[model samples]
Target: MPPHDHHHPILATQGLSHRFKPSGRGLHDITLSIPRGQFVVLAGPNGSGKSTLLRHFNGLLTPRAGTVWLDGVPVAADPARARRMVGLVFQDAESQIVGETVRDDIAFGPENLCWSCDAVDAAVRAAMDQLGLTHLADESPHLLSGGERRRLAIAGVLAMGPEVVMLDEPFANLDYPGIREVLRQVVAMHGQGRTILLAAHDLEKVVGHAQRLIIMDKGRIAADGPVVDVLPLVEQYDVRLPCQARLGMSVTSWLN
Candidate 1:
């Protein structure tokens, strides 16, 4: 059965723990609840388990000793439903493009989910239009610019009709204009009332747009709260506070 939208927390974790072999680095007792429509930024230095935690939300990686819940149901009980609810955009945009053209790429997810051909076309068209990729619908993914490629990746996820959108380092290695373009798209998605959880080491690029900030260190959640309340402690966790916050100025949107 499809999980209802009435669940208090759209996503949650309890005592979650996962340790990689040999290195023994992973999440430790992560417990948190994310309300629907919340915009959260998960920040931390490398190896802080941000990626690992996101994976658990969608059942990509099973928990070693904990539980993940989506829409009030155990994710382990219904991984397929969990994945349908949570759309994850990985750090690498290039690696996500499987189709030859932009339109084909966006339709991939819905097609795999067994949607009818008309439904797939509608979803692909809607995603491309929302991501501003309509003009490039026929273009090859290989020829897209950095910003275009990132948007394509996101469009593919959007085509899946997910309720929660999680992006891992959405803005990496892009020039200033590219960053702005991608940031705008992310903000627009959040505006549509979908829950958004973005994981990035650099907070300055996105801190302003987030309602809550979560900082992780050494595979544990070091801090989590409203962006204002968490900014002060971010540096201690190795994630730099935005320059505006450091100067006692309000963190303004990157869109400006």
Candidate 2:
């Protein structure tokens, strides 16, 4: 990891706002900051601009009203650099998979970054091992199970060695076991000290693992605070609270 100023946030948005011309589906005046090495979850109901706000983190969408800063530099000013530092794993794993085999897919990002063959190979191996995909190295990505495909998408991003990782709806279509597998990997990644931001509608799967939770509603921020503080208000924003939380029980580990 490159040395970063501890005084400044790793990522931030200042009065950021955007709207799709046709549908008017976008964020509005979203001002937030994420410190280095923090694990945060951006939670909201469907179409609440969670995805749109995340797109601005790495310059995927330019702000129409305010500014997005990455390491104190405007993301729009150096998009290439910003993207290299912030990696995104889309909700649909299939759309992002390009290589025929798992190893090839993970190597794609490093190759695009102009890394040497030896470096790319090493990165590919490390990412597979990190995500427990080493045994599936030669297997076709399309043939993998839902959990495996999600892990593959994450592996691809991990190979790029990005400073910040943002995952959108990582547990969307998975079964219980699949969700557990992905959750374990996400927890492990945070353990490794990489700043992480996960976007999801439910707090059931990842709330306990995240330190902070930011709730989005109707294209604006409704709440931003520690997970415990935000979980109680999830229902007010149209997001489902974890069953345990609803039952008045303590939120336990999803993996357990």
- How high is the CA lDDT of each candidate model? 0.92, 0.93
| Per-model TM values vs. the true structure | 0.97, 0.98
lDDT of 2 at 199: 98
lDDT for each residue of candidate 2 in 1-256, tens digit (9 for 90 to 100): 6787888899999999999989998988999999999999999989999999889988899999999999899999999888889999999999999999999999999999999999999999999999999999999998999999999999999999999999999999999999999999989989888899999997888988899999999999999999888889989999998999889987898887
Clashes of each: 0, 0
Candidate 1 residue pairs that clash: none
lDDT of 1 by residue, 70-179 (tens): 98889999999888889999999999899999999999999989999999999999999998999999999999999999999999999999999999999998999999
By summed lDDT, the worst window of 10 consecutive residues in model 2 runs over 1-10
Task: Tell me, by lDDT, which candidate is best.
Answer: 2
Error of 2 at 97 (Å): 0.5
Clashes of 2: 0
In candidate 2, list every pair of residues with a backbone clash. none
Candidate 1 structure, TM-score to reference: 0.97
Candidate 2, residue 196: how far the Cα is off, in Å: 1.0
* lDDT over C-alpha atoms for residue 90 of model 1: 90
